[model samples]
Target: MNAPTHSHPRVLVTWESKHGSTAEISYAIAGVLREHGVRVTLSRADEADIDDADDGFVIGSAVYAGHWMKHAKHFVQEYSKKLLAKPVWLFSSGPVGNPPKPDEPAVDVAEMIECTAAVEHHIFGGNLTPSR
Candidate 1:
């Protein structure tokens, strides 16, 4: 892990996960960012404090019916201005099966990305546990 070049490089990692899968992704992301010497705060979308983080953001959510969770969407709406002024990255966790179908389209965060002018976006495979 490389030490962050910037002083106090804080990153806020927020997400919305109905089944804990997306939260796992958020934690993993936070861990990686911390390993790189970034100060990280991991929280649910509704719980994150926009003012608490000034450097960057990594926001993610689980996709359902081809859309992001409502709380995640609301978080972006509420913090759009602040997010736009900083470096932001977006991620989506879906495509549950081991071998994702080729026809599965990527999670759509284009509107949010446009609003924040996000530096990057990623879509990751998710895990689904069937209820017994």
Candidate 2:
């Protein structure tokens, strides 16, 4: 008997951005995944389709006042059962300034990880523009 061979892994990269910075990061991450031959679907957390047949997930959100945007949080909460079956990675974009103010993970990250059974979490620097 022959073993099964899988096609390129499909990954969903979703995010919620208050001022667009986090969305940009999500796009960049998807681009890299595609470059490595992964099938990537990039969508906003609110608009993303959780039912897609993805092998893994990369979820991100912009942190404001130490909390993730509601849509991202809701996404995790709403689809946690599905998410728990696969590998999930979480990211937060916030803490601006030289050396990054606060220099800590988003306040809700721990809970999000627990809910999704995420394998890892990353914190990225955010860009703050006064105009937005």
Candidate 3:
């Protein structure tokens, strides 16, 4: 049989943000993926639809007290079996300061990777405003 044909890879970019910083990062990622011709579905983790038709996933969350937001954690736990069958990437956004304090990864990152079999994880500097 001829090799199966497929459309552009579809990626799900989902995030949980309490102050909107993490969500912005997710949007940027989705934009970059789109620029590269990948089809992206951007949504909040709690509201994201886990579709098997997606070829990969990029999940992110705001880190609070060294842990990922609950909605993000629940999303990964809820769809981990499906995630493991595809390419998965994880990100945590939190560390606000001139030098970006906390200089360490989120506490639950290891567990999340284990659950999702994610290929990579990234930690991005966060944005915090006094008014927030």
Task: Please report the candidate that would top TM-score against the real structure.
Answer: 3
lDDT of 2 by residue, 6-93 (tens): 6899999999998999999999999999999999988899998875578999999999889999999999999999999999999999
Task: Give the deviation of candidate 2 from the true structure as CA RMSD.
Answer: 2.1
Q: Please give, for residues 1-132, the per-residue lDDT of candidate 1 as tens digits.
A: 996465769888999999999999999899888898999988899887786445989999888777889888889888889998999998888867758542454455877787678898888877888871
- TM-scores, all candidates, are 0.86, 0.91, 0.93
Q: Which ten residues in a row have the lowest lDDT in candidate 2?
A: 95-104
Reference-based lDDT, each prediction: 0.83, 0.91, 0.92
Q: Runs in model 3 with CA error above 4 Å?
A: 1-4
Pairs of colliding residues, candidate 1: none
| Residue 80's lDDT in candidate 2 | 91
Candidate 2 — which residues are off by over 4 angstroms? 1-6
Choose 2 or 3, whichever is better by lDDT: 3
* Better candidate by TM-score, 1 or 2: 2
The predictions' CA RMSDs to the true structure, in order, are 4.8, 2.1, 1.6
Q: Tens-digit lDDT track for model 3 on 1-95?
A: 89875779999999999999998999999999999999999999999978878999999999988999999999999998999999999999997
